[model samples]
Target: MKHALLGASKAAQWINCPPSARLQESVPEDPSEYAEEGTVAHALAEIKLRRRLTLCDSKQRKALDAEYEKIKTNPFYGPEMEQAVQEYVELVEIRVMAAKARSSDAVVLLEEHLDYSDWVEEGFGTGDVVLIADGVLEVIDLKYGKGVPVSAYNNPQPRLYGLGAWAGYNYLYSIDEVYMTIIQPRLDSVSTDIMPIADLLEWAESVVKPAAVLAFAGEGDYCAGDHCRWCKVKGNCRARADENMKALAYEFKDPALMDLEEIGSILFITEQLKVWAKDVEDYASGQAMKGNPIPQWKLVEGRSNRSISDKDAAIAALRATELGTDKFLKPEELLGIGELEKRLGKKEFAALLGTWIVKPPGKPTLAPETDTRPAMNSVENDFANTDMED
Candidate 1:
């Protein structure tokens, strides 16, 4: 009953691992707080943008306001969440303005449902923001996740959204170029990829359509890559295991014995192996919990930390018994410098405490030459030179 495996958000995964679309059906789609938080953030962004544009009807405005209020009441709502949504709103506003500037007749569409069934079978998705001008179309997506920095270059999600937007608006607008932008405000990453209308359509027809057909029919390769991270079947995926195990076949006794490419291959395989091992462990644990224990394996209680069940009452009782507060709880102390900086704005805190600050050179460490940090002086040579100078 699990659906949305072929959703635009997951186009990259199914397009690459075609079999994953069907395989995902067997696994339960576990709810994620991060996802829920993102939903709330998106709702907030929609409300703010709609209000700014004065595009909302009275009823729609009231409903959105209610939804916004309800979401703000969630425990996850905080200053950071508000700020991130605001950042997305500002970026959309800027892009909309830029689009209109190019041509007075330019139109900005919000949360528009786009049908891409022209190339993909019954394919459709909503573009967060779509800007159509004289000869250009811009599809803007707001990515609420901060864990990974998403890029628009060859990124399937934005591309799919772009295609959907184009399919819906191409008839009205003489759109020659398509611009896809992924705005990840949390990570401060905004990446855009521009493609000609002809090329974008060609790629969709040649690449996406075929892949989607195979994926929907549960017939295609299970090519594994970074896209496998969020796949439901990843833990028990045989193809993933087989692919990772290919590294073990290489019997290089030591890393130094391998060439540049071999070493790189080993490194990539090692990382995949780590993921595979973790997946196996999680799958086993889950099975055991469901009374379907693995051979010679049984679930055991994990170590737990002690806690004060009734801290306030216990503390009161202790105080009544003439026990000092220090016996149970430490005296209140001033916040650490780091905490103070957070309490006061960073700039104000720095200005106040700047004179007292001292920064020591960090210890030398090994890193690839491509690292942005400057390499430290050689320890032995630096000490020797210091001694001679002294």
Candidate 2:
């Protein structure tokens, strides 16, 4: 049976550590502001290019700048940066078209979602641009993020996108091979990679299908770790602590004792812990919802005693004295506790201590308890004696 699995990036991690699935599953909706900003930028870029291509004059360029000025005050990004990026993208598109980079006789498919069933049980993806350039199918994805620059080389997402494009075009046009490319307009870099249809299909069949089956089974085979910091079910997992401890131990162990077999075993156990941790986290979350006590702990906020920076006060006090010139304590120098205690008298120092309040750590549980056990023997005897007197 085919089930909706985590995307390519997450699926790759799952092969190494199943606990990472929690992160993949708990992805929240994109921030509205970010979505709006992206839309505005893309729309502006498209408009500018279409205008430049149609008008083909310096006058049109000035008009484009004026249009950009209207939205200059927008908080998403400064107008200058936005305009620069738009211009860069326009230039790249022009260059690619000028060189006839795409095949003259190649089929063109733009902004289409393609599905491939030949590889995995039910594989589907979409490409930003697809064209049969030089008689070979090419799939391209445009990325905006600078933090993680999209690389076409050994990139699974783009490869999957290529597969989808290949599947889509192969039906209508006889395609022999597929090529993938990622253009980062912001970085002014273009990366290209090739994937053979046979290899791509093999990965889907041998790797992706089995992983999808395991994920869909809903078995207690997931684990938790630092990745749980972003997991939705972290609060429910008891195995989180165990997994965290195990990960720590593995990290701290001596490298000298690790053989190939030992390393393999460690990897396997780590994956298992990830699954178990997720299960525990899920179970605990359910318990909490039912008003049951879930075994969990948090760092107790405790106050540590610290000396106040009384440099100004000390300087002022010393300056007030008519000692030859108004020579005061240097701002750079600090008095030790012992020196301060000796200078201020024991009684005065004790009085100063009273001015400081030490806040102790609060007790853990905030819930009120219902008394279910029998009264203490002393309390029972007192109640009995009071009843006799009455």
Candidate 3:
């Protein structure tokens, strides 16, 4: 799909740093396998959604099945994608059922083009599922990636989608409220944020519109923060580099002299600073590859490992050296539980190997408070005193 210049999905970045939208305009987009996989996943989800929600005739069913078979042939598609997309479709079905309960005449729409051009300069986004009822309009988006668990609460993208949804459908329905939901089946995440139509409109007027005006014109101050993660210019953005560099401007005291509070603040800064370092490195490497070498640095082959080019011939020569089969090959081992589960599926694998498998405690690791997992019990909770369950 061709995205708008002020696309809703990138609202967070442009809203915060209005100038970034145009700054990234000329930088080519990097092809991502994860994104390709997500596209395939959404295609599968849509087919299932149409089949289950719409009353399909026999011919329609065959068509949908054929569509699904074609999707299965994609390299990124598999049983895992099939199951994840099916779960996402089921979640949408549940929401549709609830919408129908609210209004018997409720209408469900799939892949609807929602335009919020009133608040933004040609801003638009696709709502994966839109349910229009008497008093409410719901926009549900399917997040096919499992990278970062997405929440709809006060989230800019879905809120923009909500704005767009209400904009497109307000005349048809007496919508006083909008519900924006993001379903990430692979990550087992479902989040919904409810906003009254008036409040949503107010946000658009106050927060989104002003920033969008500047963004569309490619004017406004450059700012940087977490939203830089997906920016095409993140690797070379001076604003981001300056922001991360400010962490080093902190006056250093002896580690023993710095209080815990101060140390904790530094931890937060270093986390983002690390990502900045990697981005700079990657961008520089790419430049060097294109013969635009960075100052004082040139590309050089680093390392290699030798391996047999003809495994069969090598094995034949090895056998001629009086090495018997028993000497050459090791005993076969069962596949790991994760691989088995992927191959045989969850229920079947569980039924066959449930008794034989036991999960030990997972190693403890530092994570942000926003992680949904329960906190370790505090016997000092210094993390050293806790055992984490898988």
Alpha carbon lDDT at 230, candidate 2: 35
Model 2 accuracy (lDDT, Cα) = 0.57
Question: What is the C-alpha local distance difference test score of candidate 3?
Answer: 0.87
Q: Which candidate do you rate higher for lDDT, 2 or 3?
A: 3
TM-score of each: 0.85, 0.49, 0.91
Every candidate's lDDT: 0.83, 0.57, 0.87
Report RMSD for candidate 2. Answer: 22.0
Against the true structure, candidate 1 reaches a TM-score of 0.85
Q: Is 1 or 3 the stronger prediction by lDDT?
A: 3
User: Candidate 1 residues 65-166, lDDT tens each?
Assistant: 888898779876766677777888998888888988999878888888877777677677888998999799999999988887788999888888888888
Give the best candidate by TM-score: 3
